[model samples]
Target: MGKQIQLQDAAYILKAGWKLFSRRTSLETLQKDKQYREFIRHNEAAGRNNVSDEGKRVYAVATDEGVLFFSDSGKGMKTRNSYLQHLADSFFNFSKGVETLKLYEMEIPSRQVMELADNSIDKLAKSDLRNAGTQLRKSEFSFTKEKMAGKEMLEGAVCTDKYDLRPDYNNFDRLTKEFNLGISPRNYDVASLLYISENGYAGHVVADYFHPFSYEYEFRDLAEKLDDSIKARQSAPMSLHDFGYAALQMEAKVMARDILQSEFHITDGEFRLSGKANRTSQRTKTPEKCLFQQSKEPEPEKSGCQAAKHVSSVVPQKKEKKQLII
Candidate 1:
């Protein structure tokens, strides 16, 4: 233990030294960035596969270039989840990845998240449920539950709400917050929706600004309480507002597997995204498109967020209607 501690201390010193040296302190920093840019470009043209070091890698940023590759190779992968530590690192000031072995859940509910939705029932503001499908198909991302929860979570294989602790709900709360959907039918119970939809698939299928909370939620209730009847479907590929729709295709399969495995204790190998109807409707105004409302949708501009958006190629909860030509 003493030797290990000494080695870690030495590594820390070297790591800290590298960071300090890497800092762009002034105009000279800009010059160095130009140099790095040239190197990155040249490497790209040299036919290098975006092949990063594989195994278990955690990133400070999701974008490929910005991500920090890490490995817990010597100790065995599950011993400490370097990935979750990478995630929890954001919520905390520490540089080391979140020690999932340490945190049980990201946030424990004093009241079941169900209560949060219930209490806010009357207070949710009226916002549009963007149904008009936008083109989000060509976009893709690698999705997984984030790590910020404590130890039991890191060591465990399942990333359920009971273990994740990022929220009792899922990205629903985050989506609502980002778009500022001040509690109404539109903002109603985003967290609960997210919690239920975690392993299920969702992507940026469409965007429109209208007040359709009551309309959409009443018709498209987010969570499924053990409903096996909901057959998982994958429609023909046209990437319009594909987030939730595509996700449904995936999550349905995952949830189905979980139910069968845990409840029935079945280890069936015959599982895939099949046996569901895949209908492709001509791209028209989606269920979110409304004649009852006036379009106040503004053009979205990419405000100088160069590094943060690198990881999430698919902006799932975005309210923008314009397609970003990457």
Candidate 2:
């Protein structure tokens, strides 16, 4: 049986995990720091307003042991729902280790979480800081308000029947079969359904009353099929896109293992992978090899002083820590 932990504990675990995995120093800390806030405001004034969401945010962590831990920033249900669906799709398609998804709505505000992250990042060495900027640019996946506004909504036929009574068993069957779980789809409670349209656009159906149901129940598209071949025991050559996605998944799994071992101190058996785990630890350790290749020739390496000067010019220097009035 999976162990249950308190939301506060989950938050702490997530904070530690983020500090380890994310190139961003700390979301909450940077947001609260007066100087950083001013810097962001200045950037916004200059029409570069791609700042992180100030509203309640949600953080999700999934493991191979079929356990998922979620910590909500408390207020943004609509935004949270969208993000949850995205996460669900990511786990279902890319991450095969995950079995069960769980949520723990946090009591603390999102700002506090960012502050915690800021404090953690402040302790890092200058070398780590230098690497952080580059790593962040490589892995950052942002969801700007404009992008969210342009997101395609589900316009398929809406089902008046309750989720349990719904006639279409295609999606549910596919989900169960993919996971290889013993339970029926009726017993499998999901937060949402992510579907790929016949035309190839991706959309989600929240598991609510009057949810949209697509007739094209096939979840795995051509790209996904190509990606899955990379995960098979007998690996095949992958396209650049497929290889990059696979590398990212591998990196995330390594980070997840590290987080679980360090924070939870659980045995390997407790957090073991569900499928035949890929043995690519060496590749993951060398990020240069894991990163996608660029068509253009790489820029020459800069000297230490020149690199520092460039970094200073871009990132605002941190001032003395002061409490931010939220």
Candidate 3:
């Protein structure tokens, strides 16, 4: 215990915090300290037993000010003094390499996302419904008229209101209790019908913007419930806007996977990229193109966002007629 106390005292003297290395004082000062003498005696005794008198190992110490180094080879002080410079050069090269190799997910076309989601819903809707009702009732999502055809269809996910158990009929109120939609666009509810077909998926991040009494209780609650489903590509302490972006990214990835296997030869994940679909119909200013090509009809404008739009590539196309081009 006495020896341990002496070693600890020596260590405390050497430990650096937000200060520089042992530059403020001289080695002679440390040698005069009682604990330092005891530590040196212990160290020398251990070294002699190991039959090692020469020094070649590099020892480094990190402090808030910077890193310091020492060599046991008893070499000149010049080499040890330049260790910080060498370390900085190596770190700079390492940082450059890391920046070059960083990977990023390509942005999906905002316009065509709606069409992709619709097609995805058409194929996976039945399967999704079965899984929800049978195995995952708590987080089960459904395909509603608005969800399948709404403008925000691709940017948001909606869960059923039946599981709310609360007597309140208000959607916002239910969200605060223990409910959450998979994801939604910024400044909009996951279940809201307004701004369903609006363009733009951009949003800004907010700090602790959804605490219980932050008037965004529902948003906070949903974020909490979705902790498992949401995966962020950025750093920790994500905001609501980050969640929205993550949700959109997740949906796009799923749709892209499905597209790879489908007949739509729009994108090959290389040259072709997704973009927004044009609102105006080139073929016949009709409401929207039907899912089935069998019987085409003039869709009612009331069902603005109820139909899946024909997706197109980022390249400009002739204004002759509405054609699916990638």
lDDT of each: 0.27, 0.29, 0.27
Best by lDDT: 2
Per-residue lDDT of 52-133 in model 2, one digit per residue for the tens? Answer: 5333323322222321212221112222333334433443222233333223222232443433222111132444324412
Candidate 1's residue-wise lDDT over 212-322, tens digit each?
222223223333421222222223234454435545445544553454334323222211124321222121111211111113343332221111111232233353432
**Residue 186 error, candidate 1, Å:** 5.8
For each candidate, how many residue pairs have backbone atoms clashing (under 3 Å)? 35, 7, 9
Worst 10 residues of 3 by lDDT: 97-106
How do the predictions measure up, each by TM-score? 0.16, 0.19, 0.14
| TM-score, structure 2 vs. true | 0.19
Candidate 2 ranges beyond 4 A from true positions:
1-75, 91-97, 109-326
Local lDDT at 236 for model 3: 40
Residue 143 CA displacement from its true place in model 2, Å:
8.8
User: What's the CA error at residue 54 for candidate 3, in Å?
Assistant: 7.7
- Over 4 Å off, model 3: 1-4, 7-50, 53-81, 87-326
